[model samples]
Target chain A: MSMRDRLRTMGLGAFGLLLVIVSWEVIGRNQLLGRTFPALSDVLATIVDPARRGLFQRALEATIGSALRGFVFGSIIGFAMAALGVIFPPLRAGLDRLAAVMHAVPLIALGPFLIVTLSREGTPTAIATLAVVFNVFVATSAGLRVGNPLHHDVLTVLGAGSWERFRRLELPGALPFIADGLKLAAPAAVIGAILGEWFGAPRGIGIVIVSSLQNYQIDLLWSAALLGAMLSLVAFGAFSVLERWVVGRFR
Target chain B: MLSPGAELSSESDKSADGSTDPSIEHDDISISTSPVLPHVDASEIGPANLSLSGVTKRFPLGRNDTVLALDDISLDIAPGEFVALLGPSGCGKSTVLRLLCGLEEPTGGDVRIRGCHPSELVADHRLGVAFQDHALLPWATVADNVALPFKVAGQPVDNDRVRSLLELVGIAEFAKARPKQLSGGMRQRVSIARALALRPEVLLLDEPFGALDAVTRRRMNLELQDIWSTDQITTVLVTHSVEEAVFLADRVVVMTGRPGRIQTIRTPGFERPRSPELLRSPEFHELVDELTIALDEEPA
Candidate 1:
């Protein structure tokens, strides 16, 4: 893409964001939602408040750590399972069904089970991992199978063995799909972590929101929810960058 | 089946391919040939014989549907001889190349390279092929792409060989550039360079320049002819373009579409290291027109 086009896209994105913030301030200040909802400015101020800095920091740190751990674990397992399906075609349908089945099981339902089987702190990461696994597996398996026939023919005529074919063709060809999955899984991982935290985790955005709401600390609740949104947004942004790079390289 | 080590050059090889092109289907499949190698009329045969004896390929299209892409095709490509498979689209010219490269199995008969199966040649990295689609790995640089067969064969990266091939194909300057960075013609050149990197016993080209523009295609044809002349490897080229077939091959084997059978096997009497002048020559045009007409007609 040209420099002018890229700048235009960024300018449009910034304008859209500004419009949302203006709407939020206008709605909240005018008592549109009965003052229960805080303005975007108020939420931002609460996040950076000196008195509550440490509280926000600890919550951000814990949540970020859990989400990162889950993302890593989920991505690896998902990629491996997809590769397994590609190498062994017989297992493809079964693996696909397994991913679909896992997705069908609600995260909220699994929360109680996870908390019972594992600790509260571990539960968040586990749930986050499950969310990422499904996205990554589906994308990876589909990616591995795609853009292959011609390349497969090239590799085959080059005398590549099954291992070499997987290594040289299938793996690289599937990278863009894996990256896409990772991008989609990022927000999901954060959501999973927050959901898991709702089941009595020690210190996280989920915990802060739940406690603040119960104690009637409206600003704190809004601040914590906004922080969670930012965290998910940041992860999503990072993965989008990765996805762009991979697609450029692989395709 | 004709063994791979059989005579690479047989004057009778032409007759073995027969006057009736497999591209055109007649009611009679009464083609005559031994199950083994063609009866050599000439004593001075070449070094390597890449022969397909009565090779038939039937692709199963879903449960009960099966497409017979090749039907009892027989052709012997002698060592250092360049033969082009000229036919209409879907005439199974690609299938013949695929069979020789061991990408597809003949549902009947055999495809042999050097007294062994095509797979053996491929496994040993002694077979080179370039398809119409320049399947250069998108991630790899031109140099790295050219060096792939070496890496695949479990050999150390022959950077020198890769460089020379890139130079040979006139893309040495773009060695560090990835495939997507190059133009269509340039990518095809890189693919061709990569194919020649190994200097295999037999080279199979399935319309390597098919994707290029007309001008680029002509230029590439001249360049390929020059390359092939130097290497003198046994080769089978699959192309629908009569001009390309006439320009590049010792013999053009035209086939009919749909259950592909040879339509005509005509030898273009062009000398080695042929020039652009020959392309404009009356003889070349005559041969091209003849093949084009042969390609246009279907068997009764």
Candidate 2:
């Protein structure tokens, strides 16, 4: 693509983001929804408040750390399962159905049950892992199947064993797809971690948001929400960069 | 007859169970475009005899329905013989190649290579095949794609062999380039080079030039002739082009459409190292016309 085309795309994206922010400020400044939704300035003020700096810092670190841990664990497990299913095809249907059933269970219902079994502290990471698993698994499985039939035949007649076929053909072919999954799963994992934190986690942005809402500190609540959104967006952006690189190399 | 220079034709078409490789030990090729193309010592690579006796292939179409792709098709390819299976679309010419390559199991009869199962020959890394798609890995360079068979066979990549094959196919300079970077014809050359990397005994080609334009396809056909002359390995090519079959093969086996049966087999008496001069000769056109008519003839 030309430099001008790239710049235009970037310009459009910035414009879209600016429009959303302007709309939010307009609505919040007008006391939209009876002051429950605070103005962007009020939230920014709370974010910049020196007194609350330690509390927000601790909350951001905890949420981000757990979310990243969950993301890595979930992506690895999901990728491994997909590879296993491809290698031993008889297990494919069973694993696919299992993934579907797990995904079908509501997060809210799973939260209480996970809290009882693994306790509130572990629940956040567990839920985050679970949330990322489905997307990663689905993407990887589809990617593995997306290999060209002619490539398969070439490898087959070349006397490539199953392992060789996976190494040379399926794995490389699936890289772009798996990278895309990781990009999408990043935000999901952050969302899951935050939601899991709500089920009585000791400290996190989720905790701050819940307590601030109870105390009617609308600015603090909005600030915590902003922090979670920022973390999710950052994670998404990082993975998107990775996805582009993988596609460049593999596709 | 194998080549003009190496006129080694065994009396019996079928190769004995165990024999030395049947490659034509040609001294040189006249394609001056390439400088000193490396010699292939395919002498160690025994050209395996291929036999498909009363082979029938039927694919399950669901609801207890089956489509008969090949019906009682019997063919025998001598060691170092280049045979082409020509037919209309859906005539199962490609399927025949697939069966010969052990990509598909014959629903009936036996398919053998050198008195063993096709799978057995393949397991020993003795089968080479090029398909219509030029299935080069998008991620790999031309040289890497051509060197794949060595990797598949669990052997270290023979850079020298890969380079020589690339030279043989006239794509030595494009070795560093990826499949997407090359033209359609160039990618097919890489595919063909990959197929030949292992010095496979039997070369199976299913319309390797089918996707190229007319000029490119004809040129590729000529290049293939040059490559084949060096090592006249037992080859079976499946193509719809009558002229291509006549130009390349010692014998052209034409087939009828659907439930494909051998319509007629004709010996295209062309001297090899087939020159471009022969393509314009009356003999080549006459045989091509004969096969074209045979291909169009309805099954009785």
Candidate 3:
């Protein structure tokens, strides 16, 4: 399809979102949900008023900083673990069992334990980062193992060394899958950051959101949630653009 | 057609005639020998072009048994000659090409190229190969694909040479295009250009045109013959088509099915610089008929 056609399709989705927002505003203003749901206009006004006055800036900065740090640390650990697992059979089996157990453990359950054990300062963001790392590690390693047989044969005939084959073929072949995993993990990272703030944090969108809810300032709470959603969407969009750039270069 | 002894004596006489005029005498000796050695010269340059001594290839089957792909085969291909390995599907014709190209090792015996082993030449970047599938990297443009050998060998690419080779194969216009955008015939042409990029002394082709339509195949065969004649590179082609073998090859080496062996080495009687019209000639039909009968004789 042409570029213009693709843009138009995306534009239609935006238009549908506008309709949902208008409906939500009309229903909430009429007290359809008895003040539980805030009017969309009130949420927008709260966002604009504080954002214009820069009151939410520090909270926004704190949330973004913690999320970025957690994402970076988690991704690095995940990659290292995956490489170790792939290189050693015993390690792979051990990691497989460990990963299964880890996956089964609820993120919420681990939050308090991690706060007590890892942080004297009680930084719950660490727990969220750990959750994201394990998920990404599994996805990337599985993708790497799915190399094409025909492409492998071609490399073999060329007498390519193991490292050369991986660099030239396997890595590029696994990129699409790795991108999928990263996309899935991105929102999880943001959520983990927010969850950590929810349990215990001096500042962040999650803290503001909780306070707003406790005070019955439903519009402010909704605005904070909206900001978090936008943050996740932005991260996903950035990775999507990266995927396109990489695939385009190869093609 | 003369006896093998006469052909042998003629080669010896041609050597005595003059070492400077080796090319002409070689063609004469080949044509004079039973119409089986079309234009091949058995004269030595420095070493034999390709030699397989009692080569055997086997694949491990399930538990205790093994399937013999090639069995105790001995063959020689001189430099600057066109040889076609014609056979049925399971005949291991491609196996022979792979062995010659150093893509696979023999289970027993030896494979030598220009008096050195296939492995030795492969390391030195002297081997060039083309397969039935035209394994061009989809990501690379036509020009980049043709320059792969140079890149892999750490040699600087000669842009002029790449262009010339592309022109030789008649795909110069598609240099900037991706493999996915090109037609099947055009892609094969790009592959041929890539194979010739290194100017390899020995070219190994495993049914390079098997995927093409009959008309395209015939056209490619003529183009290949012209290239072979002009370049004088030793070419070993594996093909199932009898007409292709008879049309382009100086010597057609027919192989039998399971545990493939050389059934016969027939020299086609057609003249040099073969054209499409030669396909309709009586002599061409006779050669095809002979090969067809030989193929039919193998037990089902």
Q: Give me the candidate number with maximum DockQ.
A: 2
List candidate 2 stretches off by more than 4 Å.
Answer: B1-44
Regions of model 3 farther than 4 Å from truth:
A2-8, A30-34, A51-55, A70-106, A109-151, A199-202, A210-217, A248-251, B1-48, B60-66, B114-117, B269-271
TM-score of the candidate numbered 1?
Answer: 0.88
Cα lDDT tens digits for candidate 1, B1-300: 222223223434543574422211211331222112344332222224677888889999999999989887877765556788988788898888888888778999988876678887777777788889898999998899999998888889888889888888898899999998999999999988888877776788998988888999999998987677665566788887889889888777878978888666777756556788998899989988877887788778
Native interface contact recovery, model 3: 0.11
Per-residue lDDT of model 3, residues A190-217, tens digit only: 8878888877677888888889889987
The lDDT values for all models are 0.82, 0.84, 0.75
DockQ of 3: 0.26
Q: Looking at model 1, give its docking quality level.
A: medium
**In terms of TM-score, which candidate is strongest?**
2
Question: DockQ of all candidates, in order?
Answer: 0.66, 0.86, 0.26
Tens digits of per-residue lDDT, candidate 2, B1-300, equal 132112222323222331322332332432212221222233345565677888899999999999999998877767667889988999999999988888999999999887678888788787899999998999999999998999889999999999999998899999999899999999999999998888777899999999999999999999888777666667898898988888888777878867988777776655566788888898888877777777777877
Better of 1 and 3 by lDDT: 1
* Model 3 per-residue lDDT tens digits across residues B145-237: 888777666589989989998898899998999999999998888888877776766778889999999999998998898777666677899
- Cα deviation of B29 in candidate 3 (Å)? 19
Docking class of 2: high
